[model samples]
Target chain A: MTTIGENATIYREQHRVTYYECDQTGRATLATLINIAVLASEDQSDALGLTTAHVQSYGVGWVVTQYAIDVTRMPRQDETVTIAVRGSAYNPYFAFREFWIQDEQGEQLAYITSIWVLMSQEKRKIVKIIPALVTPYHSEAVKRIPRLPRPIHFEADTQTISKPYRVRFFDIDPNRHVNNAHYFDWLLDTLPAAFLLQHDLQHVDVRYENEVQYGHTVTAQVNQLPVAEDGTVTTSHVIQVGEEKCCEVTIRWQPTTQPQA
Target chain B: MTTIGENATIYREQHRVTYYECDQTGRATLATLINIAVLASEDQSDALGLTTAHVQSYGVGWVVTQYAIDVTRMPRQDETVTIAVRGSAYNPYFAFREFWIQDEQGEQLAYITSIWVLMSQEKRKIVKIIPALVTPYHSEAVKRIPRLPRPIHFEADTQTISKPYRVRFFDIDPNRHVNNAHYFDWLLDTLPAAFLLQHDLQHVDVRYENEVQYGHTVTAQVNQLPVAEDGTVTTSHVIQVGEEKCCEVTIRWQPTTQPQA
Candidate 1:
């Protein structure tokens, strides 16, 4: 079993934001931020001698089930940022991870918590977590990381806003599935452009239920929730391929400041 | 006026393919390859002290108008590839560049020829090429390079197949417009999956006409031509945003190997 100690490793990686990673506003996309975090986690796993090759050798792979992210500010293109990640803890079937993005000045920009599970490639099902799998990695459980609640179920019959998208070849990642991060783009794009332009994303909680493959046409539908007194608007999104639910996401947005003349 | 010289610099840069840059087939996407080429060109410009900031200081930016790419093979993820770029020649308003992608062993993977025009950001019009902008880059004009012919104008009423796509937030680049490369994905994805899977992209010729912005719903229409005796199929794509024609692309694909038993 992995023992908690001061010698546990916290992986750190620095990346310069590329033009392709930025959005129209020159800020790093949410998907890019998550990818940066994943890179840090992958580096940590590599350091522990648990690389993708090692996991595939055992006929299993790690899959993130849920993520909760909070952003104070989004990094801009050409900005160099650092990501620090650590395996917080693990239950029998679930492992928790925490990720932080900071600038060169050491100012925190974003914080994220994610839940992951092991899956058997042959069986296409969740596998029991073996003690050996998590023991080698540093385990320093975080006491107050934000918990991403289970995605709220949404009924399509009640949804008033629906957008259709076809999965392009570039959407597929090395894992042979539509990247989980792309779902954030699909969800946020479903909102009205006027609303999106006037607001900025504040927080997000998402859960992946099924994998989307290439050439699939997915429809994303959003159900608007009540607005808060603080001028925050919330929405629940359901992405579906035919009758299968691919994923669910909930997002919160706050009004953005108008540019001064 | 800039004079041709033997002392000009041919800019080169190396990049390792990331997971996000690969497609489901584990090969780097065509758009990703082109992005690598652009990075090399940008590096060359930056070295010449003609960075974006320098160009914008004059109220102009370089925009690629046409590209012709020939791929011998696509790079795989984790493969470090070098992109060497040089300014081959320039007319009064158009500058030509040549790009080559090779492995550490110096084996060539792809070669590209592109035509760029300086555009006034304020007036949104083609501007005269400045001698100072093209003089420092090497001008070893390629003796023979594939020329991208002007796209045959297409009548919307004649197009038989049309695919709808929204300009997602991530599609926007640092220029605040839908990236020129994303148009490649939108065009290629319009083909039937069966045809795409059975064939491999061998060459591409594209021309960018209009800039797409956030919230634009564009339609990509494809016109398939007769197959050649060598089993090569060609298609022409026209992307339109409402009544405004956005871009035109012509792609040729060759038959690929059958699936392994």
Candidate 2:
């Protein structure tokens, strides 16, 4: 972590977007964007000497529960972008962190606000945030957790499209669970390919309810809301393993001219 | 491309393996290793003014047909390794390239030899190597194609385990087809997780026979051979889209103590 001001601690890293990270439109996929943000936070934690192993030694691991992302534009292939992250505030149970991506010109491309909680590896339950575990980066301690906008629940009356996906071995991280970023792939992939090509994702609100395991076949259910007056489209998604819901996501997209394939 | 010695052109890049790229045992996945090698070759192509877009302008794009990989050990998470690649030789219809991974101490970890051919975008058929495109890499032109070891064909009598995978949107690259590296995931994931955890991959020979497109459900069929005298196990995999075969792979593994998950 680098000190920008007298009290502000920020961690920034430069990464060149590779072709494999992009989709058919030459823009980074939603999962790739989220992965880059998570990578930046992990780097920050490493710089603060609060590595994953160190935290695991305390019988807890950091797990993301929610993310609110606003994208002005997705990073393009071969573009060098900067990812900056900082721990903002924390209460007894939840920690709020912020991440932003910027192009080489310093223009911000996306901003993400995320909520994290300490989870007991053995118990598989949320644990209270230990003060010592998050004290190194100097985040403020607060009594009340911040209330961020939550993803909307799936509507019963809306028409839905569902797809089934079996979790692969590569989807499992070292923590023995599917990584959070992979949920985006399962969510957005249910949409029509033509719709994905003609639209640009503007905002996303995703909430994780339960962890998905390897070898499990999960169903992604998606429902598209009517286009807004301003020509933007909204969609709600639910990921489930059998009858148990694992994640919920709401996304807004702005239609663009058809991209040349 | 950098000149290591007179008449030798090489491209090398350093990458720190992130935790997301590793499996539960903290070692990089087969797809991740192959992706790193492909990234190095792409970087070399970019440096030599043979960018993908430039090649596509001629109505053709490079496609990998086969890969022969030998791994001493997979790189671990947070380990910075160097990936080096160079064009070795080319024929009228094929190009041969070599890639290797090295630790910080310069000890080699993995080596890959790949065969590439130009595929016409319109006809979707193999095209002869253009002299103008091959001249920049300075690889020797040979009349005879190199005879690399081929992946063994699956036997009809052998029992096979099959898993079906629907290609997702993110699986498709800028070329509008699933990237070749993704085949490794489908092939390796068919093995029992316990088997994967108890073995270390030593060598692999994969041959790509057809391209897989988005929205296709491909079945991965895997069969294991009897253990050899040296305690090595060999596995054969075939990826099929309905009646058409897309890929074939053979992998050799050495049994190790069960990894601590």
Using TM-score, give the best candidate's number. Answer: 2
Q: For candidate 1, lDDT tens digit of each residue in A118-137?
A: 99999989997766677777
Clashing residue pairs for model 2: none
> Can you write out model 1's per-residue Cα lDDT over B79-167, one digit (the tens) per residue?
88999988877767787888889987899999888888899999999998887777778553433333567766665556457888888
lDDT of 1 at B21: 80
TM-score of each: 0.85, 0.95
Compose the digit string of candidate 2's lDDT tens values, residues A1-261.
322222437889987787778888888999889888888888899898898889999999998999999999999888989999888778889988888899999999999988999999899899999988777877877776566678999864537999998998889887677887888888999999988999999999999998899989999999999999999999999999999989999999998654654
Model 1 chain B weakest lDDT span, ten residues long: B1-10
Judge the docking of candidate 1 as incorrect, acceptable, medium or high.
Answer: medium
User: Model 1 misses residue B141 by how many Å?
Assistant: 11
True-vs-predicted CA distance for residue A229, candidate 2, Å = 0.9
Quick one: best DockQ, which candidate?
2
Top model number, lDDT: 2
